[model samples]
Target: MKGYYQGFLIRDWQECDRNNAANILHSVLTEYGLPWLPTGADKDVIKVEEFYLATGGEFWVVEKQGKVVGTAAYYPVKRGEKAVEIRKMYLLPEARGQGLGKYLLTELEKTIENKGFREIWIETASVLKEAVKLYESSGYQAASGVETPRCDRIYVKYLPLE
Candidate 1:
């Protein structure tokens, strides 16, 4: 599938046998963040790997040209309840402005709704204006007065499974 931008592909993190997961994380921390860091952040990478391995959460990679250009994760917030948290959503710098983020989000919402989740919640830093816009346009509403130490905005959208 090299050089092809077919609809975003979703697969298990472990299924990414080419170490794209690590590349995805490094890209997010370096290319997308404030400052690029040296490739010696082994501890951070291990921590994320451990979480991915231990949780019931699922990680998905978005590929274009056979390269993992984006990633996202979803995990249950409460057992036996239709609630989940969307986290660690990242896309490579070269992959932005192509509506791939929105595509991933739409896929996630549909998947959650199909799985009986009544609502989907996400938290994003206030500085990420594009993300805020994506969420808002996708029917997510700003959560009033809700605050988290790591993020300035929290949004929620209800999925009606009729």
Candidate 2:
């Protein structure tokens, strides 16, 4: 994945991006008063590619002159699952409003669709109303079954795989 907006570069996650990914995840969690070292977050940030590649998934980061400013990833519910879940996507305050979120999401969606996934899901806290709207505007619909204490809402999107 390669994308740039106003000098911010979007690319695949590498081992060296570990600290940056963890920092971005930590910053978002702290900003929202959420736990910064939850089990899921810990595992993903430290070993992003390891977590995703095993399930044919991918993690990406947006960097400003080599410093990570945004993060996103999608992984299968199971190794051979038909659908995948989007996780830990965030952009720093300085990175928002530049359409980077939408741009990153578009690339992520294309990645899953290209990988032959028929559906994708994402969940978020009710407090993040902007995130909810972003998901809704991007062809995702309200979905149920996700009951994480960290999030109160789930949204899903279907793709036409060719």
Candidate 3:
């Protein structure tokens, strides 16, 4: 499944390929009232590099016709354990409703499983109804509830590693 769609490539992030992905994330998050306009510190390209090189975290970009359409990242949550967190999953408006979210998530699960991760967690705002639906549709049961200083609702999921 290297290139599932025409000109679509889901592969590791590269340093030079930052602004587009970051812009997509910023745009998506802005819809939820979460402003993350990338400053110098939040350079998507550099963030990807650091996360991959320093923490062994995995970053994936979905490109179609040589243009980025979606992005997702996975990072270790507990040291010496098979727990990880899925973060920054976003897709462009034009790319929604085509089962891309589910596809990206399924790919992420496969990656995590291969990395020995048994459980995956995600956090999202309650107001984002689409995200909530996506999580629930993907078999992510609510493990716990959380209220953060900057966030309203948080949900977690545990995947069986059979």
Candidate 4:
């Protein structure tokens, strides 16, 4: 959960990284004209430990030059048998178009599969075109029942059982 990817350190979230991670999520949402919805869609960003770590999930922060620039997390969900939902995957504007997003996602999938999760779900808005493309190209199939209020598309990738 801790390594360097293209000069950015990807590691597990810590108590000290709360504000920086939240700001990265908020900034990315705002850049895409999306609502923050702290009480709804983003409630977990403020309580990563309770919602993710405590629930047998993981939350990670990407740091460059000692500053948090991106966030990625996932939590076990009841949507499907042995499933998890990828959440809070966002990056600051300056951090986009650098292959970091794809790298983070690949790492996430590897970790999730290694942890015995068979299905990985993602819910995202169409406004985030880059994200939609990334998911589509990465073998995620379109699905329904997006639970997030701000999300309009849902995708699911089934990993081969080990």
lDDT of each: 0.66, 0.82, 0.72, 0.92
Which prediction has more favorable TM-score, 1 or 3?
A: 3
Off by over 4 Å in 4: none
lDDT of 4 by residue, 1-162 (tens): 568888999999999998888888888899889999888889899999899999999999998898899999999999998999999999987788999999999999999999999999999999999999999999999999988888999999999976
Poorest lDDT segment (10 consecutive residues) of candidate 3: 37-46
Candidate number achieving the greatest TM-score relative to the actual structure: 4
- Candidate 4 to truth, TM: 0.98
lDDT of 2 at 78: 51
Please identify which of the two predictions, 2 or 3, would achieve the higher TM-score against the true structure: 2
Summarize candidate 1's per-residue lDDT along 141-161 as a digit string, tens digits. 877544444467888887776
Off by over 4 Å in 2: 78-81
> What would the per-residue lDDT of candidate 3 be over residues 1-162, giving only the tens digit for each residue?
334744457777776668877887777778778756455423533477666547878787888887888888888876235777787788888778888788888888888888878778777777778888998888887755443333455556666657
Weakest 10 consecutive residues of candidate 2 by summed lDDT: 36-45
Candidate 1 has which clashing residue pairs, if any?
3-65
Q: Candidate 3: which stretches are off by over 4 Å?
A: 37-46, 79-81, 145-150
